[model samples]
Target: MSVDTATKPHDRLAEALAEDMGRVNTMIRERMASEHAPRIPEVTAHLVEAGGKRLRPMLTLGAARMCGYDGPYHVHLAATVEFIHTATLLHDDVVDESQQRRERPTANLLWDNTSSVLVGDYLFARSFQLMTETGSIRVLRILSNAAATIAEGEVLQLTAARDLATTEETYLKIVRGKTAALFSAAMEVGGVIAGQDDARVQAMFDYGDALGIAFQMVDDILDYAGSDATGKNIGDDFRERKLTLPVIKAVAKADAEERAFWQRTIEKGKQDDGDLGTALALLDKHAAIDATRAEAVAWADRAKAALAGLPDHPIRGMLIDLADYVVARLR
Candidate 1:
């Protein structure tokens, strides 16, 4: 399974799904518009045009295509997925007080929290409108549940952030809620809309679930080790006092004094000038970064394995590559 180091996997997927993705993008722009609330489009466009990979929506399109769907509803479903994703991002930026997203100033930063939240709500409503147009009850159920789960996950992360006592198990629940729920739903609805068999649909769900967890873990790892090209400054998680996987692993192996250090910086939010350096040193000493990376690779492997039961399509190959690319960033 040699990857062509020349072009990235996502680029390959985009190339393969160009027409479908084009429709999804068009629908996104059309739905995000509102004549009455002009500010909605402004705020939504600011984040939507911020060079996102559109991976979640692409997952929906790829899965539908792989399952032999030739209908137009897949486009609607893909747009639904993107709208849901954008909505979550808007709410998340406000919740996290994040200043930047996708290397651009967050909507909350450019406009205000009220605009961000309202626009996020508008997107959620638009997503439901698109979902209903498909006339699939199961699709609606799955996506609505995912939206709820995302909010629940956000709440869980809000409560769990900077808590030294947060276990990996709890961390996973939060991840599943906030991130993996949408990915799984996005994939599942694709198969469901395609009238795929139960086994194949379940495989789609599993692949999306595993891929989402791996994706979030990779992001967490990048917060510690990645360059600015990642759209994040290194140690942003540390400064934000987030209890991501690497930090959680490091805490698990911490000595008493190290535990006190985490309690002060992470829990109490009293980071000194040298605390980040010390935290990085401790993470290295405990191999937390490596351990977190191993878990991400494991999840990526699970995602690839879940695809074993699916049809042998070229999109399938891109999917395997996509799963590989999820963890290859660690290299």
Candidate 2:
């Protein structure tokens, strides 16, 4: 047997659980099918087949297996996690009015907002159905709360994303809502299903929370300094007027002229040529990217530290490496 050096740590993790992942993928395809509407599969298949890392579901599987679960329910739980994540992406694209995702046209653009939103809703409903199959009220409660938290986070961002006065504290709250909630739920459910003790479950939640914050902060920095490898457009956050951590830090330290520049370009939406370049220069002037990267690394450290109490399985090492990998793009 041979391994591809190009295979990422997450990829290796997936390979380690190929049988479970295959079941998860199969379950997802089966569950996503709509009885009356062929369009549902078409729209979903576009994004589902877009080659996301499937990291969330893998986390669920890894957490469960690391705790010594051999039951059939982990597969259902993993599928539910993936479905929830996909539904969120569909809704996020529509909400952002985004045109591209994973380098392909977003479902909202290829179809319409109505389809995307409805499909997302359908998946959300389907996710609930899958979770119920496990008969774990604890898992249901956790995932449902995460779903609500994700929505709440998005709404918070609606008010806060464009406002220049958005503080880092507020920004972190938004991140916890839209992004970290699911990650936390994804990992926590694993421990719950594996019948782990409360302490271990809390550890799982802690790991996911820190890892997710690091993941999102890395994404914020990548928006300024990404290559094609990231599959995201550089400066997308700047162009979208979303006040990520880098911009938040820079705004917190801006002089009068720089404040005015941000106001005109972001608040007023009166962007001009070289505005992105000017934004980059301001970020450099303040070393906002470096500071933001440092924060992400700190979160990564927190995530790894949370794993110390977990079982000393190979999956634990992979999960820790995953924390490192999430922030590695900054380097």
Candidate 3:
């Protein structure tokens, strides 16, 4: 996608890091290419070419550059982050049995589950190879641990996501695994590559962690009341029977009859006509969307705050504004 001249922080960040992003994109393309297995590149390009902000990997580049690293390995790390993200997306589409992604047919729909899963594994392996090129033991440890955490988060969601008994604590753990784990890892590894002190690296991790939480919270709220874009299509989560924070809060405040409603729609997966509308009404009645939005804002604020203890580069200001822009979707 063309970068808009509009002053969106991400777009501006892209403009600022255009040269580095070019290198990262080149690395991604080169690494995704398989010399023998043509299918690998096809599947990888389908998703990679799909339009996304590349925000997570950009965060890695941003972190490294802000810390004054001019090495070529940042490109490798950024590619590693993108490959990991793409791998998870492939697996997630299979798990969700999704028909569409980024407004196109999902790989699972076009190919098969076996293809999607194996291609995702190939990407994961590619990510590890890219990470090794960095040659920092700490970088290896941080990313490897993040990969484990990300897988763990997905498994926990498998069991806990449908269980109405899932608490805020459990939801938080799941978010850290599936979403924030990568974000945090991306940032931490960026700092590590720059050889920043432990304190700075920890702050980098905190920024990514908070930003990711806010990002997911906004997504959860969007599922309840979103469009095809900003908000998800209305009630996709309901149809999936996924117990996100909004519905979880609604369930918490449910009366006996409301409990039966949740049990029927969510726990039993016995949704009928008007069930989605009913879920929306319940969420509104409980002000769950409002509460979730508030929490998202809080996390976004925390993300901006984390940057305060670090660099004073213009990119740091962009990161702060990026946090605000994420939560601004709620507005």
Candidate 4:
């Protein structure tokens, strides 16, 4: 099912979020339109034009507004968050050799790998520049730490690929590093810049962390269950030999023949025409999908619970709804 952008859930909260994000979008467009290096604007615009949910930057803006921040610096911070996220996507496409994102050709697919990488670096540098303008050492520290964690997470996933011995703890670490770190940092910076109390800041961080985990879990589930029309290709991760949650659980519960199947397909990356069917069967037989869904729900619940101590406001309610929406597509 498609999400309705015009009439999103939690109307008032979404409106507030949209107003905050509008300033962010304007800033991103203006910053990215620099003429110093014409290629910078051209190449960066390719990825920027590729539509995404803009969830990370939205989280940053939302957290700031919810904490009573009226300053204009939130716009710069939101744009910084988006630039960082976009830069990561460019690098990720190069690493994964992915052709499609958001139902369009990835930057790496449209341009050469060198262009993707260098432009991605430029965006990173620009993001850092924007963050420095905030003059908040704590915000800088949070984002810098997140960038490091994201790198570590990517490397960990690289090592874990096709490795049948990866444990649940290692998997959690990978998810937290690769996905949740930025989410947490985005919210943390929002709180920091807003001058929120320590407890509230921590709570927002926790909320973003849980929401990100749940969001990624649903993405994993979608890879197996969502329709191709939704832009999710089934078995793509399986074909890539990436052992996500469903595959991890399925591997653990595999019987002798099932074990051999996983060994050949996941470890060796060999598969026939019916391999996806067989994998799905194994997932069903072992109830792996159900388990993964349960984990996603648990994380979503934790995200909602994290907002309990925050002051009652429409934005807080929208954040709760956004957390639910992340996992709602799974159903």
Candidate 5:
């Protein structure tokens, strides 16, 4: 279907994302409803029914369509991406002890953690099965590598938390592994499955990587700046003592007194009533938030540029807009 990019006050990019999101939604529902274990259906359904923007799967679909893929396997690949994403969310909520996602109770909150964890595994296995059905070993390798990178990233982030010595290079590695790996693999597989040339496939991979980095950077920024209404709590990362880009930058720029405060709160996990405001002020004093936003915009620009060599189409325009949308929240 052709995307209409000129219909609203918002950028046409958002509209295009919405259109691709609809197709991804259908694929997620149908695939998640498999007649496997009865309990599997119920548990998996709970998380799948929880609304998400379906951005990852849409990236897969958009990349495929933009590269002139006319086959139906794109649907299966999109579903595979969503399942992987959902599984990760289930595991993440359990690990983070988070209560809310997308303004709804997390899977671990609604069901027991055991159920959430096991169902997450089931979904991962299902994702593999779906991809294998496509019979593309290259696709399988791409996704499997992504899964490994995601796990490594999560572990890296876990290790970095509360460690004052964590470097910016380590921080970027964690984000790339945790956030951008799947995105890169998803878009790369799309072009690969479509039999696109190596350069085009690599371009899609680069685009996804940059876009994912930008997306995650914005997410980290929003944990400090966004409202609870956006489903992100202020100082959420701070409360967890997780060192994100802004926090790391602020720590580097902090004076002795500010450094002591970070040691007390982040290292000791003992936050005062005014800690959130102090953290925000420190980040502001260092211009960390602005710096982080600039980094996000740079990655997003790279994502847009990666698409320059691909063939022109409405979907290509949509992909460009989608990259823009990833960092638009910061604006």
Candidate 6:
């Protein structure tokens, strides 16, 4: 397959892995079904079909193919990764009380919190069933551990919310748990299934770990930068009083007056009119956005560097391009 320069890296990857992705999608649809409860399918279908980038599952398929895995289990694993991701999003909407996701009404909003939470639970069960089918205990262990880490991360974030005392290290720990764990597991499982050596598998894990951190950092940046394309309203994170990296960085450098502003708006949740603008101004004053972008670029670089140990395949180039595309928005 040939890709044009005009095509985005992920689009190029989708083109390259078209057949595998088709199988993964088919498996996702088939596995998301419910025999007894009709609402299960209904709630799951809403978010599953909401036109997400499917980046996590794509990482699974891309890694497996890059490692020359010809088995059908990669499809199963890809679907499993996506199911876990969708499940988290379902629960997240409920926790955040978010009405919208991927520019569509959230399952919690469209149905109710009960339906969304139950459906998310069902997906988690379904993901476990799918992983077990792979008959690779290693895959199951990796995914199960990732599932636990994701939950742990969410809990940590909950406790640290709007605290102002949340450190960059704490922020990184949250990022690794909530986002990077699955990414590393997804890629590592692919290499494991392909019987790759320990070193190569670790490299795949390293790539995904870095990529996930960069992805979340970019998301935090967009929440403040106001990207029409990302469907992120400027200051959504600010409105929620979430202590994302940019805000954390600014707080680190803030003086008494700036600290008081963050305390009132974020800690006290006493946001009033024009607070968003003031917050943006503070971020600019401290160059927080630039610092955040620098961190994202560094992670993207680490992601690309990790791929150096992988096989010389077309997928490798595509994966490298994907990492570059992830941080290109910040540039």
- Per-prediction TM-score: 0.94, 0.94, 0.94, 0.93, 0.89, 0.94
- What clash count goes with each model? 0, 0, 1, 0, 0, 0
Minimum summed lDDT over a 10-residue window in model 6 is located at: 99-108
Candidate 4 local distance difference test against the native: 0.85
Q: How close is candidate 5 to the true structure, as a TM-score?
A: 0.89
In model 1, the runs with Cα more than 4 Å from the true position are 1-6, 98-111
Worst 10 residues of 3 by lDDT: 99-108
**lDDT of every predicted structure (CA atoms):** 0.90, 0.88, 0.88, 0.85, 0.84, 0.91
As for candidate 6, its clashing pairs are none
lDDT of 2: 0.88
Tens-digit per-residue lDDT, 1-331, candidate 4: 3656655543445477787778788888887866666787787787787767677888898899899999988888889989999889889977876523423555446566777798889888889999999999889899999999998999999999999888888888999999999999999899999999899999989998998899888888888887554687788888788889998999988888999999999888778999999999989988999999999999999999999888898788889887787777776
TM-score result, candidate 3: 0.94
**Residue 329 C-alpha lDDT in model 1:** 75
Which portions of model 3 show Cα errors greater than 4 Å?
1-5, 98-111
lDDT for each residue of candidate 6 in 195-235, tens digit (9 for 90 to 100)? 89999999999999999999999999999986656666788
Q: In model 2, state the lDDT of residue 290.
A: 93
In TM-score terms, candidate 6 sits at: 0.94
Per-residue lDDT over 225-307 for candidate 3, one digit per residue giving the tens place of the 0 to 100 score: 78454534778878778879999899999999999999999888888899998999999999999999999999999999988
* CA displacement after TM-score superposition, residue 310 of candidate 5 (Å): 2.0
lDDT of 5 at 117: 90
User: lDDT tens digits, residues 52-167, model 2?
Assistant: 88989999999998889899999999999889899998888787775234345543465677888999999999999998899999999999999999999989998886799999
Candidate 5 local distance difference test against the native: 0.84
